[model samples]
Target chain A: MTVSELAQLDDFEAVALPEADREIDGAYSGDLLSWVMGRARAGNAWITIMSNINVVAVASLADTACVILAEGVIPDEEFTATAQARQVNVLRSGKPAYEISLILGSVL
Target chain B: MSDALSFHYDVDGESFSSAGQASAGVKKNLRQLGIDPEIIRKVSIAMYEGEINMVIHAGGGEADITVEDNCIVIVLTDRGPGIADIDKAMEEGYSTARDNIRALGFGAGMGLPNMKRYTDEMNISSVVGEGTTITMKVFF
Candidate 1:
């Protein structure tokens, strides 16, 4: 499914959908930025509670389809601006990371 | 090599938020040079990890990237309190970073190992109180 389609889900809300049409090939759930950067596959929807500027950088470097901020974790204004500036897709989910991953698995 | 391209940046350590700016810049430069996506990914990840480490441990540093015909070389130098043991530092999950750093989604101790995993060659030289220099190369 495309990032835009994923954002349309009930549990997910689009925070920064700069690359809304990017396809979600898989899902990677992690909060550690370095581990996520190395293991998260390109086009994977990276699920995490990390709401920092570095999160935007990692999402951009990994080329993730979108960043799913689990547990309703909302990034600050700077993070949102950086995500938009970097053109990295970002979505917010009220569910936990595992639950978000399960939801992504069902759809993707 | 006369045909080689080189870029240099001073990593600012005062803010963790700006840690990966150098890596991001390098990624953009590589993309503009038409480097393969896969190679670009490897170089950027390795350099990004290095940049994060510099901020977390070395209090910032200098990153120099040299693009050759066959390989890309990255040299990171820092003058902070140096690593006492390179082997232990290379071990996954052995970081000395504070808890606050871990709260920021880093300090899992995977930086050096991940750097090695993504690069074709890596070398580290350090002194206890002096500084550390890490050189890594990724061959396209």
Candidate 2:
């Protein structure tokens, strides 16, 4: 699925749009940025509670299709702005990480 | 692209949120240079890991990325509490990052190992009280 489709899913909110359309081939749930950078494959939806700007960096580095801020973890204005500026797709969900993961699993 | 290109940035340690800016910038420049996506990923990931280390271990540092016809060299220099044991630090899962940093989702001891993993060559030079300088290269 494309990132736009993932954002348009039920209970999903698009916080920022990616600079370009990218294919979503998989998903990963991890808070450790470095580990995720090393492990997450290109085009995975990264599910995490991390809302910092560095999260955007990790997502970009790992080539994650999008960053889903789960469990109602809305990042600060600067962070979201940075995500948008970096052209990283960021989505927020009132649902927790596991639930979103399940939804992503089904959709993909 | 016959001539090598170099970019330098000062990493700010005050905010972990800002740690990877240098890496991100380098990635952008590399992409503009038309480097292979896989090679760019390797350099960006490795440099990003080193930037995180500079912030978490050393207060902040200087990051330099030089692109050559054959390879990209990354140099990180910081004046923080230098690593006491390179061997121990090199081991994955060995981290001395404070508890607070761990709370922020880092300090996994995977920094150096991951840097080494993504780069073709890595060298570390440190003085306990002085600082540490890591030089890494990714050959295209």
Candidate 3:
């Protein structure tokens, strides 16, 4: 599923990007950085509440297909810029991380 | 061998937000070298866990990754309060991290176990109050 597909799944508003330019393969949700780093599979879309720029590093390390900032919070400008430079699709949703995860579990 | 590529990283425990930089660099390097995506992911995750542990518990550490023909080796060495009980530390959902660390979305106590899970072999040497060293291998 692409980011566009995920947007069409439920009531998850497209807050960040209009559509993902890359293909999404799996879904993972976790707040724990280390656990997510360990279990989050490649080509998967990551849903998290973390706003730190290090999240970009973790996402790159995991080779995630994209990242969805589930909480309705904006990250620092550096975060978005770096993500854009890497071509790593980053999205933000108004729903909390858990709610987004539930929505993803049902759709994905 | 001697011809294998090696990379060394200094893990800075000062900033929790910059914890995974080393692992990210390694992942990029592995990808550039044409390592299998699965193998790269495994190596990256394992090393990332180690990197976070060093920052959260050990006040910082050093990581060394060596890429051989058939295996990738990761060595993490830290100088902090060592593990008092390795067995307990290895158990799932057991962590001694402060509550502040938890608020940062870590301290789930899964770092060591995850490291073990992703690597083919894991060995730890720790001295309580002195330091700790972990060696992990992923066979390709």
Candidate 4:
């Protein structure tokens, strides 16, 4: 499934749209940007509570399809803007990280 | 042979928000140069890990990237309190970053290992009070 398709699901809310629809091949749950950068797959949904601008950078470097901010963690405007500029998808979810991971795993 | 294309950047120590700017810029440059996408990703990730280290441990530093026909070389230099043990520092899950840094989604102690893992070659030189310089090469 693509990031846009996943975002349109009931649990996720799209905060920023990527320049294109990147396919979601997998999912990774981590708050450590460095760890995620080193471990996450190219087309994964990065599930995290990190709402900082650096999150966008890490996501871009890891080539993750989208960043899902779980537990309704809202990123600042600057972060979402950077996400848009970087062509990264950002999604907000009210579910916990584990639940989001499960939901993404079942679908992707 | 002709000299390789190069770019230099000075990373600001105070801004976590801007830590990966140099790497990001380098990635763009590599893309413009028509480097292979896989090689570009490796070089960018390795350089980015170095930049984060400079910000978290060295109070910032300078990054120099040289692109050659066969490989890309990155040199990162910083003058912060140096690593006492390179071996330990290279270990995963051995971070010395403060709790605040961890709160910012870093400090997982995977920086050096990740840098080495993504690159073809890695070297480190440091003194206790002086600073550290890391050289990494990623093959194109």
Candidate 5:
């Protein structure tokens, strides 16, 4: 599923959709930025509760399709701006990371 | 060395938010140079981890990237409190980062190991009070 399509799901809300049409080939769930940076596949929808600016940097470096901020974690203005500027797609969901991963598994 | 492309940046350690800017810039430069995506990923990931470590452990540092014919070399130097135990620091689950840093999703004791994992070669030289210098290379 493409990032835009994932944004349409009821569980997720679009935060920054710079690369909305990017394809999601898999999903990776992790809170550690270093772990996610190394392990997450390029097109995976990275599911994390990390709302800091470093999240955007890691997403960009890993080339992840998008970052799914699970557990209703919302990014501050600086993070949103950086994500948009760096062309990193970000999404927010009220569900925990496990549930978000399950939803992504079902679709992707 | 004469024909190599080099880039240098002074890492600002005061702000965690800006820690990865140098890595991002290097990634962009590598992409523009048409380097292989896989190689670019390895270089950037290794450099990013080193950059984060500079900010978390050291007060700040300097990073220099040199793209040579056969490999890309990254040298990170920091003047903060140096690592007294390189072996312990290289361990996967050992970190001296404060609790606040851990709250920011780092300080999990994975920085040095991850850097080694992504690069083809890595070396560290340090003095406890003086400083630390790490040199890493990723071959093409």
Candidate 6:
């Protein structure tokens, strides 16, 4: 499912993703940066609590469909810009990564 | 298979947060080559684990990536106190990392096994006082 569809399934208060030139396919969730770096598939959602800019680097490395910042975390200005530059969909949710993972697993 | 392209990286042992930089770089290069996502993931994940192991156990280390015709080989060499028992070290929940390393979201003892899991073949060689070297491969 797309991040848009996943957003609709739960009360996320999501930070809407900018319109992308490509379509999304799947979802992946993990807190371990290395695990996500290795396991996250391209065209998939990368939901995590990591707030560092390196997280964006990892997202780029994995070619993820989007990055969902869970648990009400906020990204630094550099992060949003980097994600945008990479054309990665970046979003934020009021809920935690675990809760978002549950909704995502069921929805997508 | 020949036509090997090699790359080298020095893992920083002091920084827990920077552990996966080499793996990240390799992932980007693989994507640019239009490699299969599954193969890329396997290579990246295995290499990431090995990188972290180097940072946490060894003071730091070097990683070499050789991309051949049909497979990618990653060699991670570290100067940490080597594993005494290879079999025991391979167990999933066995970790010798300090409490500090665990706080950084690693050292759950899955590093070695995870590397083995994602790679097509893995070889680990070490001496107790010397160091450890892990060589892993992912077929294209």
- TM-score, per-candidate, Cα-based: 0.98, 0.93, 0.88, 0.97, 0.97, 0.79
C-alpha local distance difference test of each model? 0.92, 0.88, 0.84, 0.90, 0.92, 0.78
Clashing pairs in 1: none
Residue A17 accuracy (lDDT) in model 5: 98
Q: Worst lDDT window (10 residues) for model 2 chain A? A: A16-25
lDDT of 4 by residue, B8-98 (tens): 9999999998999999999899999988877888888888889998998889999999988788999999998999999999999999999
Candidate 6, residues A1-108, lDDT tens digits: the string is 666655555555445365444456677887766566546777888888877666765666566878888888888887777667655677788887778777777766
> A25-85 in candidate 1: lDDT tens per residue?
9999999998998788898999998898889999998888899999989889999999999
lDDT of 2 by residue, A2-43 (tens): 888877778799888854377788999999877898788888
Candidate 5: where are CA atoms >4 Å away? none
Model 4: fraction of the reference interface contacts it also forms: 0.72
True contacts kept of each: 0.74, 0.72, 0.72, 0.72, 0.72, 0.21
Error of 3 at A84 (Å): 2.7
Task: Tell me model 6's lDDT, rounded to 2 decimals.
Answer: 0.78
lDDT for each residue of candidate 1 in B84-127, tens digit (9 for 90 to 100):
98999999889999999999999999999999999999999999
Model 3, B1-140: lDDT tens digits are 98999999999989876788899789889989999999998998899889988998888999999999899999999999999999999998999989988887788898899999999999999999899999999999
Task: Give the DockQ-based CAPRI class for model 3.
Answer: medium
Pairs of colliding residues, candidate 4: none
For each candidate, the DockQ is 0.82, 0.71, 0.66, 0.81, 0.80, 0.34
Model 5, B14-93: lDDT tens digits are 98889889999999999999999989888888998999998988888999999999999999999988999999999987
| Clashing residue pairs found in predicted model 6 | none
Interface RMSD of each: 0.9, 1.1, 1.7, 0.8, 0.9, 3.3
Better of 2 and 5 by lDDT: 5
Clashing pairs in 3: none
Q: Tens digits of per-residue lDDT for model 4 on A1-108? A: 988898889999999986447888888999988789888988888999889888899888878889999998988889989999988899999999999978877887
Per-residue alpha-carbon lDDT of model 5 for A1-108, expressed as tens digits? Answer: 899999998998999999889999998999998789767888899999889889999999888999999898989999999999999999999999989988887888
Q: Please give, for residues B1-140, the per-residue lDDT of candidate 6 as tens digits.
A: 45678889999988765767898788878889898987887788788788878888888899999999888999999889998999998997788988877655566788788888889899999998899999998887
